[model samples]
Target: MSTNRQLVSVDYEIFGNVQGVCFRMYTEDHGKKLGVVGWVMNTREGSVKGQVQGPADKVDEMKQWLRTTGSPSSRIDRAEFSNQRDVPDLELRGFSTRYH
Candidate 1:
């Protein structure tokens, strides 16, 4: 990390028992509840990948939710987050799921 500034958006890859669970749906719902915009999708590697954008603090809270409250059937091992800054413009309109 070069500079420490407010992060407007973030990218994440959630690992462990994250697949085969309705993680994407829960994530989308949670993001909307937190007033964030992003997309979550199932990766071929049995992981979940997504990006969330909003106020810095809300984004952090959303990240925490992703790391903790995955679907009831899912066990979240960890959520690796990045791109903590450098978002000049919010790209996502609303939280959604991408099928791949």
Candidate 2:
């Protein structure tokens, strides 16, 4: 069996009731737990946006989590994923929440 794993990167923006709901915190925790590296931040437009990169399966799992589940008080109306591509290796070191 092949020991090498395929990696992928994706950009996502989540809409609806995401801001001020601990969404970025949960996202960072979940991404780390899933062994993925990424960053999440809140937008001024009242949404969440970030980029994730990791093994293909792990990335997929993270995507699902972003789409369906977030912080307890969060209401995820929709999630839009974009800029997906295959990468030779992980670009980021760890998951985190960005503040601006």
Candidate 1 lDDT by residue in tens digits, 3-93: 3334487889999898878888889999999888899999999999989988787888888888888899998887899877757667779
Q: In model 2, where do residues sit more than 4 Å from their true spots?
A: 1-4
Number of residue pairs clashing in candidate 2, backbone atoms closer than 3 angstroms, sequence gap of 3 or more or interchain? 0
Clashing pairs in 2: none
Q: Assess each prediction's global lDDT (C-alpha) against the native.
A: 0.86, 0.94
The clash tally of candidate 1 reads 0
lDDT of 1 at 100: 74
- Candidates' TM-scores? 0.88, 0.95
lDDT of 2 by residue, 3-97 (tens): 23988999999999998888999999999999999999998999999999998889999999999999999999999999999998889999989
